[model samples]
Each structure stands twice: as structure tokens, then as C-alpha cells.
Target chain A: MGIAWFVVLSAFIFCIGAAGVLTRRNPLVILLCLELMLNAGNLALLSFARAYGNGDGQVFALIVMVVAACEVVIGLGLIVAMYRNKLAIDADEMSGLRG
Target chain B: MIFEQILFFVAAAGAIGGAVGVVVLRNPFFSVLALVGHLLALAVLFLLLRAEFVAAAQVVVYAGAVMVLYVFVVAYIGGIEEPIGPSAGPLRVLGPLFAGVLLVEIAIATIGSGLRAVSSTGPAVADDFGSPEAIGALLLQKFLIAFEAASFLLLIAAVAAVVLAQRRRGLEEAGGETPLQIGRRPPTGPQAEDPAAAGSGGPAGRAIDERTPTVAQGS
Candidate 1:
């Protein structure tokens, strides 16, 4: 497997995730897209680590996983709170902070 | 060698296809399912790259734990039933336009470099290079501070999540509106005398009460 192919694949996945974040109205879907992007980045890191014959990249991917988990927790909490307050989950409706 | 290439292509197709499914699918629940597929495909790709530890972590932490959190939150929010509406105005054109530009740029950069011929046949990796033990040793030794910090970050996130999601009695007692005030008003009228009538008043209120019992039963 060539490293470049993995890089291109990851870049493609990242773009898809970015598009989802931009176009999707649901906050939960947006969060899922964010996770998708993170995963793509991790894939690239692992591919490079394999090419370089090192373990640091895998370790870094693990750390990224930990951070991503924490982020999801906080994001879900916020989404739940938002649902409680507004009785709506539409991202467009959450314009209270938009200046 | 050819077998690895075939596996890589399959995994790549799966990863990319799943990501497209996540974006194009209307329902958020279905979108999450697509993400799970995407993560699993990526894990397979990681394995193909010889990063077994990373692959396991990807499946365990992401597809297992993080996805469970997502599914739980989706269920909690009662599942977004309505299909997502089309983006309004310039966003409809601009969002895809920008994404297309990004994809084009990346494709150009990747294809122009002539890097595709460079196979991942670097030096012979140690048998333990990408194994769990090697990753753990590296994490606890070179990245020890980061390891501890990640643990600390998780602790803070757990505390913060609890605080954010907690139903605060103080706010309700102070006449301030709690976010989850579906049935915050005192039971008035004849419903006050009839406990059962009050219980079925608002769907949100009923859902809140139901959640507790289901959670208790789950545990």
C-alpha cells in the first residue's frame, strides 16, 4: 500500500465530513461529521507511522482518540441542554448567540 | 503484496463510501450509523497499514464508546424525525463550492507530487513496533505528561457533563426557569388533585420521567 493513496483517501473523507458539517442542520449530525474528520486524520497519521517505521504516530492517534471522546461528551451535554431549553434541535434556530 | 493492495482498496472504498453516506443521509440516526461504518472501515485501513494498536483503539474507543454516547444522545433527543431541509440561499451553493475546491486542491497536491509510486516498504519494522505494548511504552515514556493530561481532561469532561446535564432544583425554587421546564409550573386546576392527570400533561415531562425509570432498569 502506498502512503499517498491513504493520504488522498483521508483527504477525501475529511472533505466529506467538512461538507456535512456545513450543510447539515442537525447538531448531532454535525458532531458525527466532526468525528468522521477526526478519524480521517487518525488514518493519515497511522499510514505515515507505518511508512516511517515508528510507533509515535500510533500513540498520537490514541491520544487523539481520548481527546475526541472527551469532546463528544461535552458536545452531547450541550446538545441535551439545548434540547431542554428550546424544545428544538435545529442548528439554524440556535441563533441566540449570533451577532 | 497484491493482496494487501486489494484489501487497501476495499477498505478505502468502504471508508469513503461510508463518509458519503453520513453526509447525504437525512436522518441523524442513520447518519450516526454511517459514521460507525466509516470508523470500522478506517480501523480496517489502520490494520492494513500495520498499526494494529491504533486499529483496536479506533474500534474500541470510537466505534464502541463514542458511538454509544452518540446513540444515547440521539435517543435522548427523541430522534430527529424530520428530514433535514435544504440549505437556504448562498449556503446551498457556497458550501459545496468550498468543499469541492478543497477536494480539488487536495487531489492536485496529491497527484502532482509523484508520491504514489513510493511504496510503504521502508525499513523492516520491529515485531513490536505497532503492537499495543510498544504503543503503551511510547505513551507512558515519551508522552507520559500527555498521557496524564489526557486522563485529567477526561476527568474534567465527566464533571462538566454532569454539571451541565444536572437538573438544578435551586433554579426552579428561585423562580428562575430551568432549561428542562416542560412541566415546571405547579400542578394547577383539577390536575393538581389527580396525580395521574398531571403525569401525562406534556410529552417532554413524560419523557423526562420515563428516562429515569429506563435508566434505573438499564443499570
Candidate 2:
């Protein structure tokens, strides 16, 4: 396997994640797909880091992890707030601005 | 060498399978678990790529803390499966199609580039290249600003999560008692003070209530 293999794998995972985000109605699943996409990016970053013999990509991956955690935190909080308000859990039902 | 190859293949398979499972699983809870598997597999890949510190972080932060939050949220949300909506008709078909096209495009772009000339063995580096100490030095030296910014982002996110999940005052006024006030509180202390404050709080609370749905929809 060359660098291309890992890059291809990363792309494959990203595409899977994008499909999930597009197809899924559940916000939780959409968030999971977002994580998937981020991780795929991390994989590509690490692979390139490996190829280039540097630590910048690893550091970037660490920052990406922090951002991912923060995103999940805010997203789940929103979901909980939505649930508390007795709103419909489905994403489509919550679109109040649909003109 | 052969063992490393086998390990890479195994981790790759696990990662892909778990990603598929996350999307395919109907139960949100199951999806969360599948994501944990995916993260673990990615950690292994990270290790294989010589990102030892990053691998550890992936296991600890992404797989551990983040996934725990996901699990708790899924449980709290009652793991309700999404019913396919009317608008989902075309999207269900088009989503995978577009994603497949994207995959092909990315693959061709990356593989057909000069990156194809690069070998899998990669370049040689110091023995401590991806060790924790090395990455830590980079974090504190080269990437100190970003590291600090990340910590600040985490802090803001923590505060935002708490504020966002706070029980709305409108619901409290409507229910005549706060959710936390029922059964969990002393019978006489806060309960007696509640009605005295209700009238004074109603309009302001309703104003917040009118704003609440907009914030909720912002997600």
C-alpha cells in the first residue's frame, strides 16, 4: 500500500459519512456522520504526516479532536433542549422557516 | 512487515465496517456504539501511521469522552428512530449516489496525482518522531496558539452546552412547577416562594419562550 491507498481509504470513509449526513433524518446520526467525516480527515492528515516525516499533521489532528468534542457537546445539548421543549424529534418537522 | 500489513488491513476493514454500521443502524444507540468501534479502528490506523500520541488522543478523547457523550445523549433522547419523511424520497436515493461520485472523484484526484509516486514505507524519522514528548513540544512551541485556542473553544462549548440544555422558564410556568422542583425539592422552602415569583416572571419568561424555538431550530 502506498500513500495513495490511505488517501483513497480516507476518501471512501468521507463519502460514507457524507452519505449518512445526507440520507439520515436524525440529528444524532447526522452528528455521528460529522464525526465520521472528521475522522476521515484525520486519517488523511496522519497519512500525509507519515509520508512527509513531520508532526504538524498530528498536532492538527489533536486540534481537530478538540473541535469534534466541542461540536458534539453543543449538538447534543441542542438535541436535549429540543426534546425538553416537546418539539418533534424529526428534523423535517422542525423547519419553521420553510417558505 | 507482513504482520504490519495484516494489521493495517484489519484496522482498515474494521474502520470501514464500523462507518457503514453507524449509517445503517436504525437505533441511535447502536449507531453510537458503531462509532466507538470506528474510532478505535482509526486509533489503530493512527498508530500504524506512527502517530502514537495522536492515536492515544483518538482513543481517549474521541472514542472515550465524545462517544460517552453520544451514548448519554442517545439514552436521554430515548433512542427514537427517525421516521422517513416525505421529503426524504429523492434524497434517500440521491445521497448515496452523490457520495459514491464524490468518493470516485477524490480517489482519482489523490491517486492520480504525484502522491502516487510516494511509497507506503514513507520517509525515515527519529525514533521519537511521534512520541508524546515530541508532539507536546510541537504543541507548546510551534502550535501553542492553536493549542490554547482549542482549550478556549472547549471551555466555551462546555458553557454553551449547559446554557442550551437549561429547562426553559416557559415550560416551568406552564407546568406550575419546575421539573427539578418536583419530588427532588424540599416540600416547603422553594415551593412556597415559587408562586410569588410567577406573576413577576411570566412576560419575561414568555419573551424568552418566543425566542426559544428559534434557538432550538438553529441546530
Candidate 3:
């Protein structure tokens, strides 16, 4: 029962992140979407970790959380510096990164 | 089955609603608030699943610490101002969808592989999960590498923040100077007099004196 609820909720959140990445032009929004995706990952991991008797999944989830934090700080700082150089935080504005 | 299932559905609904609010809301402040609410409800759901330690950690780390950092950053940035178009490119959206599909597929496979685990017919203590004690033992012993890595990662993040902030215009880090630096150097007596009290000596000196950056430059 809980697994079903977790799966459905996780799926919905995952879709939002998907839609955000598909829709947002701003880099910060993209970053937010990325975080949303990571959060969904954590939900799924913890849910399975609980359903099963093993604690390994929960430990893995913790590691992911730490990694996500590092990603956010560096990503945000990069965005801020980019905005300073270009005066905009829009992902589309960063054509220099495009091939 | 009935009451437990109902409570689970309610919390699930709250979680989903908050998750939607995070994306659909115009203000990221409200979005972050919604995210906090979502994480809290999710932690409750974790408790219902009997994962007490994970639930507590979710509240402490995710809901408390991580969300606080996010709110601080959002407040510092103020608002998105220019407004993100609608979303990013389609490829970005595809990434999350792939994860969703992968999760669904895995769930299906897991359930099909063994109905016994998902049945919930017997007591949940079916296994000697020993979750709390096991987690503590692993934290202190087996996974000490990861525990150490997390702390090291946080330290690096703090240093990076300090360095980046220091590099910003007008702000400096250690061994840097400010206009206030002039006041801190060894005093040369009269020149070291407080600017606030210096030009207030005479009535006329007080007249046009404080208005200008300098006064009585002539010999």
C-alpha cells in the first residue's frame, strides 16, 4: 500500500521535474528542476530501502543527498558568476556553451 | 487495511500537492515553502513504513538543513525577475521522464519477482531489519568512508562559498583592505583625528566643511 503511494507520488514529482526542464528557460529554474529530480530519486530509494529489509538503500540515499548539495552550491555559484559576466541568468542566453 | 490505507493516501496526496506547488507557483519563496511541507509529509510517510531513523534524518537534514540553505540562497537572490521561459529544453524534461519510467519498470519487476515481500499479510517485522541499530553501526563502522566524505564535502562547500563571496565586488577576504583600513593603521596624531570631530572645530569650518569630502586643503 505504501509502496504504491510512494511510487505514484514519486512519479508525479518526477514528471514535474521533467516538465520544468522541458519548459524553463532560466538556468536557476533548470537547477531547481534538477533538485526536484534528485528529491524524487531520494523518495524512491528510501521507499525501497524500507520495503526491503536492507539498510544499504538508505545509506545510498544519504550519499546522494550530500552529492546533490555539492552540486547545488557549485551550480549556483557558476550561475551567479555567469550572470555577473553576462548580466542574465537565462539558459538560452548562454549560447557560448552551445556547440 | 482500511484506516492505514486511508492515512497513507492522505499523506501521499499532500506530498503530491506540495510537489506540484513547487513547480507551478510563480514565487520560488512559496515554492520552497511548499517543498518543505512536502518533505515533512514524506517523512511522516517514512515513519508509517517503520523507517524511523530515515524519517528523523529526513526531517533533520532534508527538511531542516538543506531546505534552510535553499531558502537562504533564494532570499539572497530575491526573485527570478526575468522569469524562466516555461521550462528548459525538451531533452532536460526527457531526463526526468526516463527516471520515472525506470522507476515504474523496476517496481513492476520487483513486485512480480516476489509477491511475498509486497503482500503485507504477515507482520512487517518479517525480517530482522534492526534498522536503527544497523544504521548506527554502519554509520560508525562500515560506511565510515562515506560519513567522512560527507563532512569533508560540507567543509569544502563552506570554503568555496567564502571564497566566491569574497571575490564579489567591494567585498574582500582575509588580508584584504577596506576604506576603514586607513583608520586602523598606526596613528600620526592629528591626521588620525576622527573625521566626525575634526571639521567641527569652528562655526565656518562647520558651515561648508562636512558637506565636502575634504576641507582647508590650502596652505
Candidate 4:
């Protein structure tokens, strides 16, 4: 397959993740979708790296993985704290700061 | 060539299907399982792209470590069996519409470009293009600062997560309040003020009372 196919596939996965973020009420599931989006970006980076015959994109993808790991760590910590305070895991129910 | 193409298609199908499952599944546990499938498929795709090191890291980091953390949090928060409430009103329609628009826009841009015709015709990669040795050399040589920064970031995240999740005895003993409960107000309004109506009075107060003793003992 061509590089275009990879790009399109990445885009499709990213959009699915975005939709999940917008629609899902559970913060844990939203975090999972975010991971999906980050993985899609890594796939696109790897495909471009192959297309260019360079290793830079691969290194960049590796760095993205590091950042993703860090994000999940902090995100899950916050979610746990939120669950402790609210006794509910729904994103919509945690709107105490909305006003 | 044909075998590679077929493998790519299979991996692509698995990735897309798993991504859909992650979004559509109600149970967070099932969503996390779908994410594992998605991550594994992405690893295969990385392999097809010749990023061997990245493929291995994908399986190790995203599929294994990250998934374990996700599942742990889901279980900790008692959310494994909780059904996600449906999106209300315009959000139900707007979310899908926005995603569809984004997909169509990307499709048009991709198709309009000449990228489809560009096969994998780049110069032959080095013998160690995606090997662990090559990646390590690049990380320690050209990208040393970035690599160090990533390590530093991870350390900071680890420390911060511990602080965020730790329950402080002093804070709880001061006014029988946890740190997060310091400035929070009791629920207002008519239904929320009733003590006899337990369910209507909000569960936060009860939850805090139930958790304090266990957390104190654990700490």
C-alpha cells in the first residue's frame, strides 16, 4: 500500500478517538480514546519515516510514546482523585467548577 | 510484495475495528481491552513500516504498561461495570457530525495529493535503520538532550502522581477534611439539603466518610 493509505487510516483512527472524547461520559474511557489518538499519530509518523528513508520520524514517535506515558500517569492520578471526591466517575457530573 | 500488502490490510482492519470498539463499548474494562487490540495492531503496522524498535516499544509501552495503568485506574474507581450515560441533546448529534466532517476533509486532502502514487521508493535504509542499536545511537548522540528531557519528564510525572494520589493524615485530621475537601461546599438546594433522603443528598459526604478510615489505616 501507498503512504497515502497509511495517512488516511491514521486520520480515520484519530477521528474515531475524537468522537469518543466528545461523546463518552466516563473519564477513563475518554483517556483510552486519547491514547488511541496518540497511537494514530505515531503510526503516521512511522509511515512518513519510511517514506523518507530517515530515522528521525521513528525517534520522534518514540518521544511521543514517552510523553503519552507521562500523560496517562498524571491523567489517571487526577481521575482517581476526582473519583475520590465525587463518588461518581461521569465527566458530566464533575462540573462543579463550571460556573 | 503482495504478502506485505495483505498484512497491512489485515492490520489496518484490526486497528480500525478496535478503535471503533473502544468508542462504542459502554464498559470501561471492555474499552480498555479494545485499546489493547488497537495498540497491538498499531505495533504490527509499525513493523510493516520497518520501525522495528518502535513496534516493540508500542507493544511494551502502550499495549502493556499503559493498558495496565488504565485497567488499574478503572478498577480503583469502581468503574469497570458502570455504564456510561448517553450524551444529551445536541452533543449526541454534533459529536458524530464533527467527526464525519473531519474524516471527509482528511480524505479529500489525501486524495487530492499525489501521495497515492508514491510507493515505498525511498532510498534503501541503512542495515540498522530500525534496530535497537541504531535507535540507541541516535538517542545518545544526536538526540541526547531530548532523551534526557523525556527521562526527566517521566520522573516528574511519577513524583507528581504519587503526591496527587497520596492521602495526607494531617490534612484529614485537621478538620476531618482531605486536601481536596478543604474549600468544597456541601450540596445546596432543596433536594440536596435533606438528610433523611440519603440518595438525594449527594454521595460525596458518605463516600468521604467511608474512605477516611481505610485510607488512614493503609497509610
Strongest candidate by TM-score:
2
- Order the numbered candidates by DockQ, best leading: 2, 1, 4, 3
lDDT of 4 by residue, A1-99 (tens): 677778889999999999999888888888888998998899888888888888989999999999999999998988887766655777777778641
User: Across residues B55-143, which tens digit of lDDT does each residue of candidate 2 receive?
Assistant: 99888888888888888888887989665433547877888889999988997788677663355668888899899999999999999
Q: For residues B1-219, what per-residue lDDT tens digits would candidate 3 score against the true structure?
A: 798778888888888787777766767777778888888888777766666777788889878887787777777677775453324466555655665676577656655655454444224553435367877787778899999988899889878866665565644333366544564332323323555444443245332423343354311
Q: For model 3, what is the error of residue A72's alpha carbon versus the real structure, in angstroms, after optimal superposition? A: 2.6
TM-score: the better of candidates 3 and 4? 4
Off by over 4 Å in 2: A97-99, B83-87, B167-219
**Of 3 and 4, which scores higher on lDDT?**
4
The digit string of per-residue lDDT tens for model 1 on A1-99 reads 668788889889989988888888788888888888888889878877877888888888888898889989999998988877755787777878642
lDDT of 2 by residue, A1-99 (tens): 466667778998999999999888888899999999999999999899898898999899889888988999998888888888778777667777442
Model 1 over residues B1-219: C-alpha lDDT tens digits?
A: 999889888988989889999888877788889889989999899887788888888888889988988888888887776565454767767777788899999888767765433354555787877888888889889999999999999999999999888754344565655533645434343244554555465356444644444334435
Q: What is the lDDT of residue A79 in candidate 2?
A: 84
Top candidate, metric DockQ? 2
Candidate with more favorable, higher TM-score: 2 or 4:
2
Candidate 1 TM-score versus the reference: 0.81
**Residue lDDT tens for model 4, B34-120:** 999988998998888889999999898788888998888877776556454443768878888899999899788777766633354
Runs off by more than 4 Å, candidate 1: B85-87, B113-121, B167-170, B176-219
lDDT accuracy of residue B116 in candidate 4: 36
State the lDDT at B176 in candidate 4. 66
